[model samples]
Target: MIEEMGQQSLFNILISLMVLIAVWWSVQSIRFDLFLKDPEGIKAKGFMVVLTLALTYLVTSFILNYLNWSQTLRFLF
Candidate 1:
């Protein structure tokens, strides 16, 4: 169970990083109507989006762990 929780935490962190990177790429490369209309607004929107995702994932994982929902008999070995 401990091992599983560790792996899950690691996986969640990696996914969050990937999401942040994707958000960065989208914000940098795309010029959608909403974004093009206001550069500062677009920047703020992107920051909010990434922040929300990170916070949600962290909160959910914390709740899950607090509830002892970790899997058993799972290890990277």
Candidate 2:
């Protein structure tokens, strides 16, 4: 049980890291100049990137937890 918990923790960390990298890559690929034509454009872009990363992490974690819970429930039943 302890080993299984550790494995699940590691898997969650890996998934979170992957999601972070993907979000960063997507944010970096965007043409900020075309979208935010202002002196604060870079700041805006950074904020958006952070926001997106946070949201992605939240969603990914939620889905993972839900899946894990469902599997546990199946085993219980």
Candidate 3:
């Protein structure tokens, strides 16, 4: 039981990191130069990091919640 729990935690951690990186990578398509005073500046980079984190939180929450809901639904049968 302990081993299973450890693996589950590790899986969740890895999945979160993957999601975070994916979101960051996908966001690069946007043209930040059109909006920022200095698109390549430190502030622009920091903004991207913050925006990515917010998006990641929202996405991961939905994913984990869906998994939880699906697992619970199994009890209805």
TM-score of each: 0.43, 0.62, 0.87
Tens digits of per-residue lDDT, candidate 2, 1-77, equal 99999998999888888877777777676666676767256788677767777877887888798887888897785
Compared with the true structure, what per-residue lDDT tens digits does model 1 show for residues 1-77? 99988997887777667656665565565555564556568676786566657765666566556545445325433
Task: Give the Å error, residue 72, model 2.
Answer: 2.9
lDDT of 3 by residue, 22-64 (tens): 9999889889999999999999999999999999989988888
Model 2 residue 22 distance off true place after TM-score fit, in angstroms: 1.6
Give the clashing pairs for model 2: none
Is 1 or 3 the stronger prediction by TM-score?
A: 3
Ranking by lDDT: 3, 2, 1
> 39 in model 3: Cα distance from truth in Å?
0.8
lDDT of 3 at 25: 92
lDDT of 3 at 63: 85
Q: What is the C-alpha RMSD of each candidate to the true structure, in Å?
A: 7.4, 3.0, 1.3
Alpha-carbon deviation at 7 in model 1, angstroms: 0.7
